[model samples]
Target: MSLGGESWRWLLASSSIPAIAVVLLRIGVPESPRWLLSQGRVDQARAVVERLRGNVEAFEDLVRNHVSARRVRYRELFGKKYWRNTAFGTIFYNAQVVPYFAIYTFLPLVLLKMGVGEEDTTSDGLLNLFLLAGSLGGLWLVAKMSRRGLTIWSFVFLIATMAPMAIWPDAPTALLFPLFLVFTFTMSAAVNLDQVYPPELFPTDLRSSGVGLLNGLSRVGSAIGTFLLPLALDGIGFSPTMLILTLVLVGGLVVSLLWAPETKNSTMD
Candidate 1:
């Protein structure tokens, strides 16, 4: 049933379909209402809000209270007022993604080391389901929980789930696999906040630039982690590598406690 030697080329090329679809779909998307309001386009912003079924009165209030017409330069993100946000965004994103990409990129090797065979398709399917469930759960919890609480607690649970395997790398497959699944679920859930937090952290004028900067930096971290993961596993072995990643999660927890803001019910302003 396997394909020819050129299968990798087709598989890689297939990704462009989604990319092209996104480009086409984005053509019809409206500009950000908040950004419009920031630019003094109150009527256009209100129209966008109304079309989206958002709170028009709130949008009006936002418009009325809008004071700044000055656009934020990228350098301002490093200024005193936004410096903590920049630091938090960069650290928080890297903390979540570094281990995330590293582990998932080499998941097969990870599972094999934990005694799961490549033939264990059922476990793979179950793990994917758990990831999906976790993502949905995260979306639900984003409304019910404070953003700070969710970010902190998710990091706490991620550390808890990972510490065991790091501490006992040779634990029984039964125990280790379940821990891995918990880690997967927690990671998937927490990753959703990546989409939520950065924009909220910045004002409308700076939002796009701030998010763009964070995303760019986060990808650098991901790239480095993905590249170094296999080398770490080879040189330091799985146990130490897991320990290192657990430390990274701990770093995330500390950063969240110190800097993650509660934007759950707050206005975009």
Candidate 2:
């Protein structure tokens, strides 16, 4: 558990060991009924559905006309029917990535620059504790509120919180520190939308592909943000860099307004 220096590398690698356990756990699990149905295994799908659910009749009716043995094509992602969903998911995922990755990557450095000590465990612990609380609160909101509303409002809060620090990078630590907490709170709360919506937005036929596309493309954005953040911070200073980030959030807000659909308590199309 030692996490210093190269020990962190071992800690990261050790995390993957659980995946092996998971693979073993999946050895006897039934294939997804929908996937079985898609493969034209109607009897197997029905049996799996009956085993998993008490009623197969309702599930059958729901998927009866929709289920097909036709092969899925990658081009469906770009086809007229799904191209908009694809764009929305990718933008939604990647927009959050740029800010989240950059900010968290340099959070410690930002704190140090603001006069907090490098080894200030108390400050870091408190931030993480509040982040967990925010995540739970977000889960509550995700179930009760419109996904689009939560996302738009969270981006607004993020832009508002970033404004002060961007406008006055040298503000007193007391005034600026709470801004960090608020930013973290909103960012954590808003993360549910980023994580949930992509899967919900796509139909079962394309769900995995859509989510994979979202994740894969967003990671590229994260990598770019992580790489460019330091350069931007050093070259442009905190205020202008933050101003640019604010604009990025604005773009997210606009996308959510124009394209994001509400999926809470709603049936998938």
Using lDDT as the measure, which candidate wins? 1
Lowest-sum lDDT 10-residue window in model 1 = 63-72
Worst 10-residue lDDT window for candidate 2 reads 62-71
TM-score of 1: 0.93
Model 2: residues with Cα > 4 Å off, grouped in runs: 1-7, 10-14, 17-30, 67-71
The residue-by-residue lDDT of candidate 2 on 12-87, one tens digit each, is 7997899999999999799877777777778888888888774777767856676465567888999998888898
Candidate 2: how many backbone clashes?
0
Instruction: Return the top candidate by TM-score.
Output: 1
After TM-score superposition, what is the CA distance of residue 256 in candidate 2 from its true location, in Å?
Answer: 0.6
lDDT of 2 at 128: 98
Which pairs clash (backbone N, Cα, C closer than 3 Å) in model 1? none
TM-score of each: 0.93, 0.87
